[model samples]
Target: LMEEGYFEPNNESGRNRDVYQFLDGVAAHSKHMQQEGEARRLLRNLIFIFEENDLSQLRNRISELILYFKSQYPGKKDLPYIQQLKGMLREWESDLKWGHLGFNAFHVHHLRLGFYKGEIFTETPRMDRDVAPLLALMQQVKPTIVTVALDPEGSGPDTHYKVLQTVSQALRIYQEEEKPNKLEVWGYRNVWYRFHPSEVTTLIPVSLNSMAVMEAAFETCFGSQREASFPSYELDGPFSRLSRKILVEQYQDIKCCLGREFFNESKHLRLRASHGMVYLKKMTPDEFFQTSRELKKSTENIE
Candidate 1:
């Protein structure tokens, strides 16, 4: 659940906030949490952020950002941006609900390649090298539920599809070796893309309060996105705003079909929007692997 670039700083609403600014905000929030006497807990979930390369010439800019953070935080002046970012992530992880359950974790992969909008497959070696360790990690965790972005070809950036392929391949390898077990691969989409109502199998309604919390987390943890570099002109506000609209729309659609009385009588329905987070059809591990392989082969043919 991590990306190489911190945020799309070019977004108009983001105001050109860079990675350094984002990490600063995250560090500040971590300090605030510490002062509040919050307990520190381990996180089980893994988050990988590839840092060696990025689009828009971000590698050099990230180097500059590291120096900026080093200068800003006297105590951490000697450390690099990646280290500082890791520390901040650890702190944020501590504040997550998963942290309370001692199941939060993250990693910054030092992969050799950077992410170009449509060149993920062209850099096959990097992708395959990255996937080997991931396969091993998956074997260790043996998770039953693996969630991934449901991005289609030519939608958003190509990185999303590459990630989906990598995870799917890893799962395929792991399943071949281990005992047969039930596995569910959940496909999700966010602001960059969306799942059609007909394509969705799950809808987790979110409350206004929960939305606020999510926004706060974004504000605190994603300083870089505060002033985005590549702001979307099509949208009026941040991605969160888009998310709210989508969730509300989904909730309304459901209510309309089920009748307003159904929502009025349910306590949870009263607080939640008309629609919630939408997921695409769930796929079994074998199904996902086959789909990913087919997509990979198609890409190869085109290349």
Candidate 2:
């Protein structure tokens, strides 16, 4: 995906003819067709709808987005994205129920913010729509721990990095205005990035039982990502498999250091030790800011 040098210009006329036919009765037959297949079809043929030139139209509630699609396409059973979204919803709802959200509230807010619509999280004359939700969340939740991903290779330069920047601004504002209590940031990385031995503050052992549980949960939910259209690193398989591979690789690295004899001798702990470990870097609010600063180059006029 990151090829340098000039590439041949795309011929508009040579565009695939199927694009036209696919989108022809999309509004009508989308209900009759498979949700997953229809979602992929929409993505292939009409992704440009999301890239509307108008910035205002680009920003919307997920509800509004769904409504817009429903209005645009009549007689739709549901978009494939809808089915996957439902799966995610079911997972979260089930988790909330299992965890017992008695006194604590579990709120999931969608900012729907992006740089593609020319949105900037950096200092400007006015506040960015993206950072506002995060700022509000801080005031509303008064969370003891705020979690953010450290990975930086998402859509581009990691949509996550951009998200982190905005979050930094939000935390900055929250600190200045609210004078919040002691807060910690739990920084995480998927397969894209990881904490080095020197940086890790904690380690969670990944056991075979835990791996089975994770695999079950992942398979039951996350259908959209399990079968992503534009896959990660051109991988045809699910990211879960790649993640497991990485975990095992890390375990091997650890096994080399500690000596295979140490693990081979441990009767009860051997299985889990062979599986691998999860590294965690817990940071304070100040350390959180410093980490993001180190992650990015150039200065922002946030002050």
Candidate 3:
């Protein structure tokens, strides 16, 4: 409005000058007047002063009047200005909380998942040395419950024995520390490392069998390994015992017991089946058991 000339400055000149005229105005000091002409002339002079740049004097007069009012009501007992200010502050705070921060209940769940996945470690592995910060973050985020699903052989140590050893050490550490909330591991068959519900972390390994049998079974039931691979699960590590069972279930059109029910063939299932057979079949006992003491000593001697 200021830019569009909806309002005019008292001192504006030339092209910007757009003035309004008022007639029959009464002067505030008319009580001291003796003639009507004096009153009219005084009002005309006041209008001319407003046109001439007398805004500063008018502002000073307004300020003096405000000071008088404040002095009369020092606590502002009858004014709603305090309430208006409070309402503005509350609106600003609400905008900051909902609009700027963009935080909600779901964030806590995501944070809990990220915490369990060691995504924080991925972000800053050095922070692993001081878990207090992570615990504090967990508390601040405040997840109701955290569920962790781990295929340990796929993501644990680089190889099977090291994974076992690491899990063992972790189990011992958990036992010693006796931490409150725990972990759970899941798979098809029975595992060597089992956890009591009371434990902080649970280790579950479902043993399975070779992929060749699974592929052969997929071929048998679905007429192609692709269909069979969807229902079949191959040995993920040397310890998996359900590999044969997974293959048999796939081939015989029997229901798979390892969580999945529907069999929609996709690239991942095919690749996993093909890759599982290609790699797992090629592995010999010696290659799989790299941590054997005799083999390690032989390897060292070779080095």
Candidate 4:
């Protein structure tokens, strides 16, 4: 908006005025922005600040932001190897954050079967073509276990549901032809949803240090989603922050029910008294199908 003149600075006049100047220029005072409704509006409007950065532009913008912060505000603290930072923010790594993960990353061509609004279910042929390579990958790997997001009904942004359907379909075909002897489907939830203790088969404890790692990884890896244009209304920041909040909340809830002593005195003290716990539901192929089928029905009805 600043670049496009939809917004203007209060005192600054340069075309490349940074965010602080932009806020001052527009008189977006902290007192004014602190109002709940106004804060939400500002958050939503600013979420997609990098929505159209075609890789190279995204990289450039990251550099620009760093430089803007460094040279312009080279205070007595905070800085880094500016040239070293340029590579990551530009990679096509929306999913896999770390550059090393690229060693195993496979880009499924034309796999983005839907747009922002989610898959409408009318694009069957396109979806089928996209799912073909995935099935082929399964055949080649012959993995015994697979993990998938299990956001029910209205939990996630529509894409997770679309992916669930696609993966489920591929799994069915793979099982039918390959006749895999044993396969376990592990369903997990993140910021979009949660599973009650009774609903989960296992609780994998997350370390306090791991929580810090998660935050750092997110803030570093997802430069584009820093603004997360279509962020959840529940929070003003990125989904990573929301996920961390959810995890902490879950830990507190567990402490209440199981008693804090159970954690603090457990043999695995570090893990037991950790920041969060992962809820996992393990199922056979048939059971996975049942759960997914129910979720599919609910999603379609809602749609």
| Best by the TM-score measure | 4
Ranking by TM-score: 4, 1, 2, 3
The lDDT for every candidate, in the order shown, is 0.54, 0.56, 0.30, 0.61
Q: Give per-residue CA lDDT, model 3, range 1-303, as digits (tens).
A: 334533342333311111111111112333233233232322223334345325577567546546856775332332343333223333322322232234322231211111222121222222333233444454454433322221233233223333233333333344345443433332212222222223222222212333444333332222112222223234433322344443344333312322233222434554223222110111222222332333335433644
- Candidate with maximal lDDT: 4
* Candidate 2 C-alpha lDDT tens digits along 22-80: 23333345533334433333332222334332334434534576675667532234555
* Candidate 3, residue 138: lDDT: 41
Instruction: For candidate 1, write residues 218-252 as lDDT tens digits.
Output: 54544445555455554656656666677777777
Better of 1 and 3 by TM-score: 1
Candidate 3 global CA lDDT score: 0.30
lDDT of 4 at 135: 83
Error of 3 at 255 (Å): 2.2
**Span of 10 residues, lowest total lDDT, candidate 3:** 14-23
- The stretch of ten residues in a row with the least summed lDDT in candidate 4 is 9-18
Q: Estimate each model's TM-score.
A: 0.60, 0.59, 0.18, 0.63
- Is 2 or 3 the stronger prediction by TM-score? 2
lDDT of 4 by residue, 1-303 (tens): 434543232212221122223233224544443233223222222233544324466567667765766565322222333322222223323323433233212332223333222233223323446567678778888989988999875676666766777778889999999998889999999878888878888877778788887876676446557777567777889877888888888888887889988888788867565978778999998899999998977767743
Return the candidate ranking by lDDT, descending. 4, 2, 1, 3
